[model samples]
Target: MTLPAVLRSAAYPYRANSLNLFRLILAAAVLFAHSWYIAGRGTGPSLQGENLGGWAVAGFFVLSGFLITRSRLRSTPGDYLLHRVARIYPAFVVVLVVTAAVFAPIALLVETGSLQGYLTTPVTPLQYMWGNLPLEIQHYNIGATLQSVPYPGAWNGSLWTLFYEFLCYLVVWVLGFLAVVRRSPVVVGALFLVSVAVYAALGVAQRGGLDESFALFARLLPFFLGGSAVFYLVERWGTNLIFGVASLAAAVGLIAAIPHWGGQVAAPCLAYGLLSLSAVIPQPGWIAKNDISYGFYIYAWPVQQLTVLFGGAQWGMIVYLAITVVVTAAFAWLSWVLVERPVMLAIRERRAKGSTRSEQLPGDIQPAAGT
Candidate 1:
């Protein structure tokens, strides 16, 4: 059968596309946005009261939701959970270790002239790495290592979102196991609606009291759900340029009209529009082959802090950003090459070995991917 103008399955296949390039851009955008703060200026500029980094993160959630949902629907429960853990935890664990052992010590040596008293500090390097091993950022600084930096105490400010992102993953997992996503996506769509309602109720909830984590979850949940909605819609209707444009127009209007929360409400359209765009845009072979966006994001803040320790804060925003791009990109490349890709490839190979051709689905759809 001839496909629609463009097949959603084709645009959002498990691998190979401009999505990687888009993710790279988003990751760098975070680095660029954070340069101001790392250099002691402040949040440089923002849209609708959210910083550029914040918007980039929201964009990440939208894409992740779509991609991760696809992952769940296509894999076994055990395999899906393992892939999620392997994808997120190993690199995260590596970054934490690097921040604590390498960067923090360097920060101490630069500040106090020795790593002599380091182990006796309040939260020692081991403690710092161990405390946050679970993805929840329980420790933001290794003792007093980052206290002198411009942002002060937060070594990896970008890390807090990982906890929320994992939670979103688990949420999708639970929904997938119940057949809610594949069988009754309208319920998934409704969850997005409820999250949006919570978004509208946030101001009132803050005055009346509400958990910060839940509030943050409410903020990101719609985007994730919207992504899931987009996946289903695209699968059902395929992609059309006109619909993509119209969806983007609607998303833009919501984003402009609503203040801080409009983007969450606009997520499905935004995700669809962007995914549709991805169908048309061709990605570079280099970026399409290797995904370092996750590494770039996780490593950026600490690298920036190190840059500050060496007096990068005085170099001005442009210089700081330039240096950061080079250093962080290198780290990201190493992460994909050394840790993330190898670990994932190993796990994928193991799973493939365990499965047989008879068990495969007729039109087995592949996940787009987040990390």
Candidate 2:
């Protein structure tokens, strides 16, 4: 197909595109945004009236909703659930185990003079693992992990979002299983509207009553749903330069007009902006080849903390960010090659052995797909 024709085709099969690189950049953006506070600096600058980290995270959800919803359409509930579990849990479990068995003990011993004392603490390794379960686990400090650092106590501040990411995945799965997404595109669209209403309500409550995390989730849910809506929009209207331009324009307008309400208007605009950019830009070959965004996201905070511990938080933000990028990227590459990629391959291979051909649907982002 011609370039314009591909742009307008809902089934253009963009698995060949640069989503992996795009997501890696988003992950790096989060790391960059977090450097300020982690390095004992105050809040950093915002971009186009939104916090950079917040914007990067919302972009993640938008991309996830777009991709995962697409995956759901071509999967049985069993396969869909399995794919999610394989994708999220293995690396997560590995990180948790390492944190508990390795990092936590070291940190606790640093805090107290005794490993025995660390063991005697109430937060056992088992509790540490168990507490971060089902979803929304607050098992952050296993007896003072990273307690000596600038951003002390929180081993991984980035973790809280994974819970929400999984929650959004489950929402998509449940909605998909119920045919709310597949059989009734209108229902999915309506849910987007409902999400906006919830976001608005939470925005009001955040000023007076709601917890900040709760408010954040409420604010982000609309973006996830908005991504799903975009999938249907592509299916119905197909992608086009005109629509892409309009989406970008609308996003700019929203950022200017509704700078409050925790990005209620900005979410859909972000989704469209992401999609439009992908549509218009050519993804680099090397970036599209390997998916390291997940590893980067999960590992960046801890690595940054470690940097602060060793190098001192007095380092300038640029130096901190520069050091962090090099270290975190190395760790992320290792994670992809050693943990995430291998586990996913084993799962896929095991499943493949049972069947004659690959069971995954077209355009279903595999576990290796960035974010």
Best by lDDT: 1
lDDT of 2 at 243: 64
TM-score of 1: 0.91
Tens digits of per-residue lDDT for model 1, 1-371: 77564432443443434777778788888888888877888788888887888778877888888778777787888777887788888888899888887888889888888788687787878888888988788888777677777788788888888888889889988998685568767888999998899888898888787888778878888888898878787766666666778888998899889987799999999888877777667888887778878888988988888898898768677788888899999999999999988987797578778972222221111212222
What does each candidate score in C-alpha RMSD?
3.6, 3.7
Candidate 2 backbone overlaps, count: 0
| lDDT tens readout by residue for model 2, 280-316 | 5776676665677888887887778877876645667
Clashes of each: 0, 0
Q: What is the TM-score of each candidate against the true structure?
A: 0.91, 0.86
Candidate 2, residue 122: CA error in Å?
Answer: 4.5
Give the deviation of candidate 1 from the true structure as CA RMSD.
3.6
Overall local distance difference test of candidate 2: 0.71
lDDT of each: 0.78, 0.71
